[model samples]
Structures are given as structure tokens and as C-alpha cells.
Target: MTTTIRNGIMIAAMALALGACASKGAPTSQFDFGPLPAAAPASASSIGAIIVADVTGPAALDTERMHYRLLYSDARQSRPYAYNQWTSTPSQLLTQRIKASLAQAGVKVLSTTDAAASTTVLRMEVEDFAQNFDSATASSGVVRLRASVFRMHRLVDQKTFSRSVPAPSADAAGGARALADASDAVAADLLGWLAALPPSKE
Candidate 1:
């Protein structure tokens, strides 16, 4: 009977130690871009359909971590948060937002799996996506993307969009909010740019 009791106590103590270790190494918080606004109604001149290619970025922006820069320390240097991360890769999130925004605006957005005749295609490359800290208390979310419009495999137009939104705080949460706001602005501009182009011919 005494042996049995001693073994049970040891088992319980081991369990508690394991639980404490798990709690200490809990999973980090993850985030997404948040809700997107409803797309504006499609204009009569909107193209019939267009393909949105997956956005690509550098190794840093291509990751799921929330990245930031201490401009005061090194304007050209950046670092990622260890405990805060994005639910999806930054490029992936940006691509989803772009497609959703275009569709909401009444544009016919197509995926790579869709089959269609020669159609206009939009290619985007993310050059920069990070929070920049001018001071310990001040920061800004900066986003830069290069957009190219193609019609029936022919390049029609290309432009680069760069935006900086002031962050409410110098943290990941604030960066996320600022980035979301900048994304909306970029989407609106993309809508207008695509709408002005002539429809593609198969």
C-alpha cells in the first residue's frame, strides 16, 4: 500500500512539471490583415476577366513573421518579432486581399486553375512590407509593390505603388492595423488603374 501511494505521488509531480514546461513555451500569437471592405460596384467598362498571379517578395517579406525596422539604429536594417507572427505569409495575404478587392469591385478575377482564352493578367511583386520605427515611440507601416498589366500576353502597363501609414503604436498590433489601411488604399488605386485599360481580345 505504501509503495502504491509513493508511485502515484511521483506520477502526479511529473505531470505537473510537464504542464509547467508546456505553459512556459506556449504558442505565440498570430495575426491576419483583418476584414476587407466590400468592393465597389463594377463599372460598365470593367474587363470581363483577369488573372491575378501569386505575389512574390524577398525572403524576409515572404515569411510569416511580423517584421520591423529600427530606423534610428540602422535605417537599412530590419528584424522580425519572435512572439508575434502572421497567420499566412505576407505575399499570400496580399494576394488574397487583391483578388477579393477586385472581385468585390465587380471585376472578374480568375485563379490559376481557371481555363479561359487569352485574358488580361495582373502580376504583382512585393518589394517591401515592414514596420519602420523612427523612434522608440513612433513607427510607420511601409508597403511597396510593383504591378504589371498584361493583355493577351502583351504587357500593357506597369507601375509601382509605395505607401506609408503612421502606426498607432510601435508594436506588431499597430503595424498590422497600419498595413491593413495601406492595403485598402493600394487596392483602390489598382481598381482604377485596371478599369481604365481596354478589354483584352482572344
Candidate 2:
């Protein structure tokens, strides 16, 4: 081929590559827990006016990215979706959900910033928060959190809550819905545990 023709073909390929990159750079779609379901009837609680501390999580989950893992291919590597993100960090989302769920159940949920005297405090740490795929077409949202209840600096009790809910679809939207469900399930379990506790001696 002539040198002129070869240069023209190379330039065309570069233009096409740049065009593809620009398309990929389009704005990403953001997500959150969406909305909590219709709450059940509120009931009286012995655990009254408790405080909820901010949730802490690994550095990976400290961002707004939507994370997922392909267990069938590479289980150790977690990847973020190219065109989707979370409206907030995973820890923040969980914090909001837990507080809302507790309030809906008739617990007097208070934030750490709120004034309280010798009130019960709940602290939580995120262990794992990601969508894992069993196969190319199947996945589940998984959440693992460790919670500690304290009163006047004394550890009252500690427990870990976890859930793995199957996604409706294999995409990011499905993952978000599944994670919201799993989070709600965990929050409900935490409520049960809290309710079973005897009134604090304080």
C-alpha cells in the first residue's frame, strides 16, 4: 500500500478510538437505598431514646461507587460499575437505613450529635458490602455488619448481622434493590436483638 493510504487508515482508527472513549466518558448514573417499605405498626420499647453512632467501613466501601465481585471468575477482585454509582457511601447509606428502620419500629432513635445523658449507644462496622455473582447471569447482594451496644462507656453487648439477598436482575439496579432488601433484613434482626435485652441498669 502507498504511504499516504496507510497514514489515512491509521488516522481514521485514532479518530474512532477517541470517539469511543468520549462515549464511555458520559455521565454516570447515581443510586441510593431508594425508599424504605411501608413500616409496620410502632410498638412501645423498653430501649428508649438510644443513640446511633456513625457507621465505619473499609476504605473500599468509603466511596459512592457501586461495587461487585465475580465469584465464578475472580472472587478476590471487587470492581465498580463503569456507568453507575451510589448517591452516598455504603456506610452512610446503612446509617440512614438503620436509623429510619429503628424509628419506624417505635424506638426513640437519636444521633450522636444529639444531647443525651448516659443513654445507650449503638456503634457498627461494615465487614462486607458488595454484590457477588455466582454465574454470569446470577448475583446476590451481601451485607455483613458488627454492632456493639454500650452504656456509659461500658460494653453492654455485641453481635454481627449479615444477609445475602438474590438480585432481581444481574445489573446494577438489581444489585441496589437486593442490597436494600438485605439491609432492611439486617435492621429488623437488630431490632429483635435490641428488644430482647433487659432494660439497662443505668
> Which numbered prediction scores highest in lDDT against the true structure?
2
Please, what are the lDDT tens digits per residue for candidate 1 over residues 1-202?
5999777756754543343234555678888889887665657255678888999889876778787777755678666676778999989999999888888877778876664743678899988888887766678888889999887677899989888899987677898888887877788888888888776665
**Model 1 CA deviation exceeding 4 Å by range:** 1-27, 40-44, 115-118
lDDT of 1: 0.78
Stretches of model 2 off by over 4 angstroms after superposition: 1-23, 41-44
TM-score of each: 0.82, 0.85
Number of backbone-clashing residue pairs for each candidate, in the order shown: 0, 0
Write candidate 2's Cα lDDT for 86-105 as tens digits.
89999999999999999988
Compute the lDDT of residue 52 as modeled in candidate 2.
Answer: 93
Q: What is the lDDT of residue 94 in candidate 1?
A: 92
